[model samples]
Target: MTATQAKPRQPDLKTSLPGPKTAEIMARDQATLSTSYMRPYPFVPDFGKGVWLTDVDGNTMLDFFAGIAVSTTGHAHPHVVQAVQRQIEKFTHVCLTDYPQEITTSLAERLVKHVERPGEKWRVFFSNSGAEAVEAAVKLARNHTGRQHIISTMGSFHGRTYGAITLTGSKTKYKRGFGPLLPAVSHVPYPNPFRPPLGSTPENCGQAVIDHIESLFVGILPADEVAAIIVEPMQGEGGYIVPPADFLPGLRALCDKHGIMLIFDEVQAGMGRTGKMFSFQHFDVQPDIITSAKGIASGMPLGALLAKESVMTWPVGSHGSTYGGNPVAAAASHATLDLLEGQVKHEGCGDSLMDNAAQVGDFILGELKGMQDEFPFIGDVRGRGLFIGIEFVKPDGSPDGALRDQASMMMFEKGLLNLDCGEAVIRISPPLILTREEAATGLDIMRGVFQELK
Candidate 1:
């Protein structure tokens, strides 16, 4: 099948969702699995191919969520699967740090090359997940600057680990009851054009955020003590928020002025999700460090901390991971990158998958905006590339979390897989390889849900 072609057999729902087999598996899952996992609807998957998922009972569903944007090349891309299979057959383990592997080194080289900047050399440190990448970046920033304080934006979701969760400011639930978090971390408001704070306009929101950071420096934290300022180019969990155009550039200037490292947490927005190899590429400014993982290896467990070589001054034993750059995962990553960069193009598809993201994402955004005009609950529609979000709000313009939840569940019941983020925002982060027809199908389901909810 061509990259842009929709599955010939679309969403064949034979039985009610959570059919007999699904119910049986779910019953066993509830008994054995941890309650921490949030399964919004009982759509248990037996297998997936491309943008389609098959439940245990043979019900087919469209996967617009892409496993939370981890499946960059789409589910079970032949290239990635073949690469993993070949690598595993050779040998999967042999901790890279303890015993160097060529595949891991090769993948790191490619990642460094992808982020290369003139007069600035980059190096990659592998980890097992986005949180680990964040942790590594934080440690490296501290070690390089010899400073303790770190800054993150409000409405940001870094990760769930202690240091990562400490940096997250999107929701208190993630931080609640896990207090005494890594100290010296502070959160400043992130610029949101749609719901500007203090009634700031899009033109001034960036400046307002900078002014707030300046105030913090003077009143609370000393600028010299701040080691780094981490942010997402396009906020993900904090509601696929796209900051004002000037926000990132202004933040970069501020970080430079304070001699602070600027870290871009592209775990959710990177790896071709935003029509670029990295989301920060959308802005002219460059960050000192980048944490990437999701979609890096088309759903494989891998994370990377890409940093300027000069800033990664910590000694050898300072950090290491046993499974950070498994050969199998690295092989898969190489294949994933191949498809993303268009080195290996499927028949009749565009040169690169990122190009597809731009085209289809614009189409999806246009449709959502058109729908917003008709639906009062769609208070806002914003995003870049495929990483879009639709905010639900009451008539008074207050966030309507309940309505958002209801709509999301309704979409699931209709055989469309989606996810909610922030307080009342529904995020649409499908695989980068998504086609226009597939996107329209998902949006149609959303429209039906919105109509019913209204």
Candidate 2:
């Protein structure tokens, strides 16, 4: 059923946030779970359905984070669940390297076709996570170009693996203590319309970034040594920053001028997250390689590195994954594509989901913009579709991370689930199937929280 048709339910707090059961579970988690996992608040979920999550205390809270944007079709979507169930009934794993699976081949074919490059042909490599997809893309780029250096934008998050972390420029915290990182990787500024560098206006920030890269080519790094330039069309973990319209096209032109391959790390922004199959579609520029994962399989462990046919020239055994193409995950991905593209017969499904993302996202952005007028703490509001970020700042215009954290905690107490990114920004990335009513409910709760916090 479509999200709109589904029964609308608001937050139902039966007990205080993180009641007895939740607190007990969290205590156990503290004792057993790894300390590395960051828990902003005590939101121990017992179950989730559609855009609503029920914590162990039986409080139903509106889900705006979507498991950090992993649950593309909402929690336990029937189509995805059924597909996985069917696949498991037959066999679970055969190791893609040793045995062939039609489900894997089918998913690859569908992804290539959906990428919509017109005359260009593309190939796919399966992996288990976004980091693995990035690692695969890096390998392909280096192997194809026979070059040693790679360039990435500052404030971009690729992944946490050794190679992927080396390419990531979002935060030093992600790279701290992991010294002697992979060499030959450099970072440049990404165009931020709200805070442009080099005294650049939004209209010219795109060119400013390109100019910096050009300077790099002439000064320290030679263009010939750079194999690839990896970027997020919409920066995610760094902040949901959307560059100027000309930014991506300018990068494409720069890549064409040199022989460097352009790679888009779409792990957080792809698979209809931004009202498009891929975030780059909004810019009308295509990349040589695209890495996808987070929402591709509706919470299943699946990722893919798609590349132009000519760029995927690595020989056999150069790279392979034992559990990359697990049948259940592939099946879940196929089902996800069907739902995302509106192949299902349900009303308000498929392509309508993307449309909803755009419409509802605009509504939320408008509401927040309106709020900014009353509350100067809101520094900026920017995003495309459902992938959005709201920056908080002090009176002097410096980042107000403490205020942001306080607001988030307050919102959590009020039964809204969201997350923070960058220095002081709240990221709102709901599931693709989120309806306008659901979004409005969450926005209303946020409005109340803002009023209280302000």
Candidate 3:
């Protein structure tokens, strides 16, 4: 061990999972909240600072999932807290659609710089969540192209809203019994490298998906009538499935050839999660429209749709949101960008958060890769930056979701918080502010739990 490196702190557990206070809260929550809400573990968190959360019962634990990858700057990061506080004191809401506001405009301008192409002007539409952004993009695509057919890859999760759910192909449960999904929406093959579609090689998986779409165009879905092809640059809920390097570029070419708008749903992978401002940047592909939400406001609800000026053909009053661009959320987003861009450095952060994500993600990925030989259930490890996936498989090389579920609960009991994606992948998408020592600690805990399971 390096003598200069500080030892990571350990978790403080004074009680069991769902301690007395937490159990009480859960009971009340079940009675009061929607029955649809899902909680993988019973955690009644009352406080959070940086990469740790303290529950109502005073037990403290390390957070590795960051509230399903929503807390970008970390919990209650002072810069974000202060920015939100200042914004709250100034004003909370006035609605951006009807009112011209400075903070909202400023956030939009800053985000535009990150999304716009070299010679193309760009514009933004704000919403309260990622699903709204996807909905907005769909409307814009159809409105601009005057087409009915929209294509999305299977194993994709847009959101729960009508149009977004219709585009979501990850789980039928998301669309279950919701009769009459949006019409003319088609689902095609996703280029999942780990489990390639249509018996295509990992290298050709993406092309197989492209070919499947071409076949569709010649058959039922006409190429001329397609409005947009919405897909995640790297699939999130469908597994942190990073497609082959050729996928996004190929999709771009196809979209260009057919005059179809290409939409990159970056809700879970954007805002520095993948070591880039946008996940699509890694593939060197420019989407006609980009939908973002999860990490944009650092836990505050904020979503955005960025599109080429020419493509955002819908005129004003065509779509509007009463509380889309809340000033407080805009302020929080600016603070998040500041931390992410290295405009404001938190303690122990040597560089930008994006750099931190890359470095720590690389460190963890290397450790996990090394462990694969000794741990056969560690079937595959893949991701870009911190958006990682650890696939748990049986001896027969099939996904072992049961083992994953057990390991997730075990990790929770051991005071490490992570969540599963797809059927069996545990995603280690921690807040970008996580430090090296914390990363090492998380790895230690994970290794111990995995060893126990093995």
Candidate 4:
């Protein structure tokens, strides 16, 4: 088949979703695994290729969520697999302390180029996941600045670690029982146009955030004591909420004014998921540090903290990870970066894939706007590139988490995999490699679900 003709497709359901056998497997899993970490879906994915997954029952399903925004190069890309295969044949792991590997050095070099600052050099510290990246970034900032306080927004979702969770803002549910969190963290309001707090409009939300943070410095923590301000250029789990045009640049200015390091958590939105190398690129606001993990090394566990050289000065024995830059993982990352940089493609389709995201994302967003008009439950729809969200609200446009739950279940039953976020937002950040036609098909399926709910 030709390159275009070989594009992956949506799921073909010959039988009901989660058929009897899949349900049996999931039920067995539920009985054995802890409920806290296990969320049994209707499908048991056996394997995936490109944009489609074949479940154990031999059903092919479209992968819209892309393993929660990872797999940007799409599942099992030939080059990535080959790289991993080649590495395993040679050697799997060599302790970094004793033997530094070429693959790790190459991956770090590639990362430095991607996250370079205009006038300064860059460095990276590797980890196993996004949360670890955030923890490392916060620690780096603390060590570099000699400050104890960190600032985050109220609707953020950093990670689950004590330090990361302390920096997260979405409350109670994730933080309820986990007490004695890392201290000296305060939250400012995150900008949300659809349901602004204190009756503010979208246009003014950026200024409100600035004012709120400024008030904190005056009343709570002093600016010099604040080590870093961690934020998502586009909030991921907090509804894929894209701040106002001024939000990021404004925050950058505030960080500059206060001499606090700005950290961008690109864990979910980086690596072409936002149709760019990074979401921050679209906004022209450069963060002092960046935390990235998902989509960095395809599906393997890898996260990195990219920082300006000035803030990267940690004394020896400050912090380290045993498997942070494992050679096997680094080989995967090197191959993944090669694909992202257009070195490997079916037919030079990498950039075209980004263009596909913009075109298809525009159509999906338009369809969603139409749906919002028809269904009052849809309070708003906003995002850049392919990282989209649909916020649910009451008749008065306040958050309606219960209604969102109902609608999500309705969609799930109809063979779509969607994730709920914030209080009542539905996020649709699919893989970067999704074709225009596949995106339309997913949108159409979603529209049908919304119509059925209406």
Candidate 5:
């Protein structure tokens, strides 16, 4: 029997999770997959549908992480499944080096139209993951400007690969044993009004970042030597830090003044996860190149480096990926995009869902803020759409990862799949398709944990 058929008709939390079956599987996994990649959850997922996952022990988990923001349209979404099934029967792989597939071409054309950069044409290069997209963005910046240096902000995460890891600044553990990294990548402080680097107000933090970049160019890396400035519209693995409202436009101005490329790593924030087609759209400031991956294909492996036509000047043979634009992935992407655009007229992300996110997100934030007032451990609550974070603090207002870790572990046993990020922030990025009622259920579960801890 198929997985869905063999499973119980509805979710059941029987016999405490990691029940004999799941424990056995996890034991085997420890010897197989790298320790670094294994998750902390004890229950192993058997399959998923909609916003829920059925674990090996038959426990149903409300997936708040959304595969870390990849399953925006939800798990096993029908449109995505049908698209992939159709594509798989025809052909799965095609060499872009040999002949481009129609699926990829369609995706690229739609992306260009979606970008709508002022007075700028757009192009896209397909990739297999967010890290590859970051690599492409950096390469495009270097080749376009004939410069060597790239600038990223502290408390930012581009990806895990060499170049992307070099750009990431959240933790040194990601780079400690990796040895030498990409050359000439510089870091500046990101605008965090809550804990300002130099005591700047939130209103002025945008200009502060701009000023810092300007000083860096004059006193550190020269303008002519800089290629691009990469930033997350809303920092993801970096504590869900949302910069000042004026930050993106200010960066755009500085980049334009210095002939430096502006690259937005939207891997974690794009694809309607933030209630907009793209997070950059929220700022009305366009980047020369934007990299996306996590939610693009709703869990299928896919990424794209979108650039204004002028910046996408690499020669025909400059770059290519064997499975980058695989027909199956492209079909999944098309289906995912259609669902996002509401063309499929699906149950997810209709006007009802988007409105619900704003409504419940506000409630959750308010509740978290109340908790902050009661418990000194709750430091902050901030996010856009459903991509929210609750950062923790000590009584002295310093980061206290230990307490946060304890709270997270407590939630895990309670059957929630939340993840921690940045210094001591808890991520609550559930699938975009998650309902208002479902969010309330999960938030109440979380609130119960906070109450217990208090």
Candidate 6:
């Protein structure tokens, strides 16, 4: 009856994971699909309605990842579905760059209004994916500041495009064979408190990174020649790491001192994923530009680059994307933003989905911290709202990626969908509409998996 009193749960699965039907489809996929594609688990989805996903094997599972945190309003919410249908009925593509598109223009206005930054004018540029937004950010920062050098944090994931990949400091696999990436990009350590970079303690890691960049200015890269310092306010693929409290603000002050642009790659952490409208809100900082995509349009393909009006100095015909702001995607984004901003409310636990995320996130984080005492492998539990991670560790205190991999697969088999990030962490970024009951369900499965691991 009460939120905390909800019972532990398990999906009444009809078949084993990757049943006959799913296996056959996977075989076909292996033969036909590109070799570069990676399947974390053998979950072949039939359809998803709300927080539940039914696999091709006819087994139902609670979706904990939300298509890697893209379905902001959950899978196929009626509002987003209806918006897409209406836009499709009228027309689909019309290149928002050249034409005057009403849906995109209005959506841009809505985005500007929700920024919550007073007295600062903003501009929006639409793209089809986060990588494109990063590309645009790179160009805009360079063009606006008349500088070429860029700085990014180690273990940050921007995207896979040339500029984005160059900026990305995560796994080398993402950059494998993609030699000759965009030049003049340098990486500095992100101020992760749990495992502080270069043996620095949590309290000083933020300042340490800032000091390193200051040293860079004096020795290698001059401060005046750097265009931007891009970062993920809270990292995504790099194990869902949250930087120190002073990290973002330190970067902001350094950029201000150097006349360098600060870019926040919010592709995974934006769209109300972190309780607030953006992850940057949690910290006392304002970025010169923001790039977002993952959860923007509630499953539709849409990306956005929002910058201060002064930084958006790129002239017309400077850059273009033919299908960036397609009407259908714009419509879906409009509905998604409406729900996020509470213009269209879902009658659930709280005033808005953002409220639900904060409330539920607090509950889950408390539960996870308790689990750490019981589970020796659970070295760390950190998050903002639903953007959570559970790090596994070996006896020697190093990351236990092997055990983390096993736990993720075990959860999937038990009818709970999840994924691993960083070296040994489970990411718990679910849909915004996830209920307390749903949270309990996943938490129960997580408990079982850790118990088994123990």
lDDT against the true structure, per candidate, is 0.90, 0.89, 0.92, 0.82, 0.83, 0.90
Candidate that beats the other on lDDT, 2 or 5, i.e. the better one: 2
User: Of models 4 and 6, which has the larger lDDT?
Assistant: 6
Query: How well is each residue in 1-454 modelled by candidate 3, as lDDT tens digits?
Result: 5999866788889998889999999999999999899978999999999999999999999999998889999999999999999999998999888998999999999999998777989899999999999999999999999998899988899999999999999988888899699999999888988888899998899999998898988888779999999999989999999999888998899999999999999999999999999998898789889999999999999999999998988987999999898899999999999988988887786679988898888888999999999889999999988999999999999999999999899999999989999998999999999888898899989899989988
Candidate 3's error at 390, in angstroms? 0.5
- Summarize candidate 6's per-residue lDDT along 343-380 as a digit string, tens digits: 89986747788888888988999999998889989999
| Residue 15 miss distance in model 1 (angstroms) | 1.3
User: Candidate 3: where are CA atoms >4 Å away?
Assistant: 1-6
Predicted model with the maximum lDDT: 3
lDDT of 1 by residue, 261-307 (tens): 99999999999888999988998988999999989999889999999
lDDT winner between candidates 5 and 6:
6
TM-score of each model, in listed order: 0.97, 0.96, 0.98, 0.93, 0.94, 0.97
RMSD (Cα, Å) for all candidates, in order, is 2.5, 2.6, 1.2, 2.8, 4.3, 1.9
Runs of candidate 2 exceeding 4 Å displacement: 1-8, 345-351
Count of steric clashes across candidates, in order:
0, 1, 0, 0, 0, 1
Candidate 5: where are CA atoms >4 Å away?
Answer: 1-12, 352-363, 374-376
| Cα lDDT, model 5, residue 196 | 71
What C-alpha lDDT, on a 0 to 100 scale, does residue 11 get in candidate 1? 72
Q: Least accurate stretch of 10 residues (summed lDDT) in model 5?
A: 3-12
lDDT at residue 21 of model 4 (Cα atoms): 73
* Candidate 6: worst-modelled 10 consecutive residues by lDDT: 6-15
Clashing pairs in 4: none
Best by TM-score: 3
The clash number for model 2 is 1
Query: Residue 3 CA error for candidate 1 (Å)?
Result: 24
